[model samples]
Target: MKPKASPKTDQSTVRQRIVDMAARLFHQQGYNQTGINQLIEEAGVAKASLYQHFKTKDDVLQAYLAQVSQDWFRQVERAIAPLDTPKEKVLALFDLLKSFLESVDFRGCNFQNALVELPPAELNTRQLIRGHKTKMSQVITDLLADADPDLAAQISLLFEGALITSQLYHSVEPVNAARRIVERLL
Candidate 1:
């Protein structure tokens, strides 16, 4: 006999639970360090259910990255919404990064972390990372529409460097320095 299907809401809940647990685990520990069994236990879902929702752990990682991308963009939009002028908004981006670093205890960029942890063979995950970064660069580009086109690229590099440096130092000093450089650039 075939097994009965779960309700739609239950299935959605299970999937979200798994993704949420995976996000936390993958962030707190590197992706490879987290095990499928731990995800099942922490998510409070059956092993079969996890496989039902995600054919592989990589699928779960993809979902986590997607969710993070959406959340990150939303936060950025909200952070810059109240500012006036492109320069102010662009500078505010660094402030937002500083807040984020402190909030996460200087864990650094999730996309960067995933890129470092995931093998190049994981093309889908790498593409997601690239897409998120491209979108972020576009945001800066749009904000600097009146300025030299190349400034956006320079600022993007500075932003990424600051994140990595902040993570290394376990402090927001790098973010502050990046903000100073951005101020000069603007």
Candidate 2:
């Protein structure tokens, strides 16, 4: 006879589905506006199932932040991997960012948008955003160490400026401009 599936296995699968759906919704619709009911409906999970995964809506938001953080970092690592030199690796990040900017579905950077939209009460989400940004900056600093140690700070600043400008201008030029600056710095 086939072994029976445990409730824990079903519960874990439902929880992951919820988190994945929540991440998609939060990215598309902002956190403050998305409701738990809508999330369950989208995830195709019951309220009890959601609660089995997350105690509160805040817990789901925390999970979303953590998920996005990991996803973004993995993308960054993959984007930077093709190039050999540290400078190339660092500049490749801007290339990765440009691809995002040019994406038709791009609304903006979910992390920065979350920082502005989520309430001060959402400390876990805020911390996750902060941690991701710090790690990104550290990666830049590390890559720039061999080339122009002094340029690491500028690179991070330029990266952030480009991110904001790309969203603000709704164009890919800011990424190009940042790339040009990075090229000059190298």
Candidate 3:
């Protein structure tokens, strides 16, 4: 005999399914290009179920952005966890970016991509993107607390640049080059 799943658990699972499918679709295709009907179809959930979880398409997008922000930070923290020094951790960030870019086939930053697709009126979505970036900058600042204050800012810029360049060229060479520059800065 199998155990029965609780109502809450079932609902949560369905919600997660929608969000996961939304992330994949939104990332693979532009945000504006992905329709609610497509998300419902791909997620294998009924239209009612999708609406039950997310009131609007923007709500689903907000949820996706929130999830990605948490996931991205966790990945960054894990990647830098083993390093002993601030500089080492900072350099490791670039290495992590290289691996991440390769793993995603140079898809580039999700927030950056979303920003381009979003209209200027999307204040909430824009705020979420800005918050993610601000948190990332804070992480760099924390890592370089004892170094020249400007280094963190500079590294952050390089990191973003590397991501864009890597995506543009469909290669990780830009990430490697960024790592070298970071090494020199450190």
Best by lDDT: 1
TM-scores for every predicted model: 0.95, 0.90, 0.97
- For model 2, the local distance difference test gives 0.85
* Per-residue accuracy of model 3 over 27-144 as CA lDDT, tens digit each: 8897999999999999999999999999999899989999999999999999999899998898988888898888888888888989999888989999999999999889999999
The clash count of every prediction, one per candidate, is 0, 0, 0
- Which stretches of model 3 miss by more than 4 angstroms? none
lDDT of 1 at 91: 92
- lDDT measured at residue 9 in model 2 versus the true structure, 0 to 100: 89
In the order shown, the candidates' Cα RMSDs to the true structure are 3.7, 2.0, 0.9
The CA lDDT at 164 in model 1 is 94
Clashing pairs in 2: none
Model 3, position 123: C-alpha lDDT score: 93
Clashing pairs in 3: none
State which candidate, 1 or 3, has the greater lDDT: 1
Off by over 4 Å in 2: 1-5, 147-150
Give residue 149's error in model 3 in angstroms. Answer: 1.3
lDDT (C-alpha) at residue 48 in model 1: 95
